[model samples]
Target: MSVDPVEQWSGVLDRFEADIALAVSGGEPVPWNPPVEAEAGPLPEELADRARRILDAQLESMAMLGKVRNDALAHLDALSAVPDSQSSAGPLFLDVQG
Candidate 1:
């Protein structure tokens, strides 16, 4: 027997919720799942609407996370580019005057 569309959608939603939680907390990475094509039938309006809302939030969170990660990487690169006297293997000198 074929799987019910509602059940398939519910599974998708459950996985999505877990992924969102992990993403927000910076936990283990969530593997990408292929998109699920809807069967040839209409889903309950309420279910569809709720799923859409969840999807929209997920997309927004993903975007924000990407931006934060990119920003952090950029900052690290900038810090690495700066010249540091400590890098050289030589005697260090410090001058203090009152």
Candidate 2:
């Protein structure tokens, strides 16, 4: 028997939500691979709210990841701007003969 489109759409959302949940649960290995596409076409009115919730969560995750990327890049840039210790003529620390 063929599954109804609405049922298929609901299942897509269910998987999407579960994936998001796994990511949010703070597991380092939980990959963020989302469904390639919903394939259900236009969403039905009944599932609109659920879809909106998923979209909101996705946006938030994107924003959070963007911040993390920017922060890491900034740190990398700062480190790169610093001269290497080997390049300096003097020792990094002053040694007391006493």
Candidate 3:
């Protein structure tokens, strides 16, 4: 028996939702099932709209993660650029008269 298009879309939506939830939970990485345009193209308007919304949320999440990764790398680079304190013969902190 052929699967109903609506049912197929629902299944896809369900998987995406679960994966999104897993991502937010900080759980193990999801084997994300991104929607394929060929399969999604024939979906009914309402279901397609739902899929688009999910895709948008995923895109936002990915952009956020990219920003966070870049920020973390920048911090690491900053720390690495700091000169090693051990190389100096001077005391670690200069006593401020304040």
Candidate 4:
């Protein structure tokens, strides 16, 4: 059975939201690869503008997530560079006497 365009777009948006949520929560992005079918004519003006806006927002969000991940990795790298003070202490044992 052929699916309606509205239904298809709705499903795609739903998946897009879910994937975005996963990415926001520090999980691997769940790819939403819907089948691409070519349309016979250009999209309506309003639909085209809405799609453009959504795409722009999605791209912006992805870029922000990438920055956050990169920043965290950089911070970890900086921390790893610091020498552990315990390593310099050379294994001391303490005993308590009553």
Could you tell me every candidate's TM-score relative to the true structure? 0.68, 0.65, 0.65, 0.61
Q: lDDT for each of the candidates? A: 0.77, 0.78, 0.79, 0.68
Tens-digit per-residue lDDT, 33-95, candidate 2? 543455566678899999999999978876877787799999999999998998999789876
Q: Which regions of candidate 4 fall more than 4 Å away from where they truly are? A: 36-46, 89-98
What would the per-residue lDDT of candidate 4 be over residues 1-98, giving only the tens digit for each residue? Answer: 66566666655555666676677777887556665765223334435555676677679778998899899999999999987878866646556684
Candidate 4 residue pairs in backbone clash: none
* Candidate that scores best on TM-score: 1
- Candidate 3 Cα misplacement greater than 4 A, ranges: 33-41, 83-98
Clashing pairs in 3: none
lDDT of 1 by residue, 1-98 (tens): 88877776677677788888888888897578654455524555657877888889899988999999999999999999976877867657656773
Which of the two candidates, 3 or 4, achieves a greater lDDT against the reference? 3
Q: What's each prediction's clash count?
A: 0, 0, 0, 0
For candidate 3, write residues 1-98 as lDDT tens digits: 65667877788888887777677666687566566767654777778778898999889778877887899999999999988998977788877996
Runs of candidate 1 exceeding 4 Å displacement: 35-44, 84-86, 89-98
The lDDT, on a scale of 0 to 1, for candidate 3 is 0.79
lDDT of 1 at 77: 100
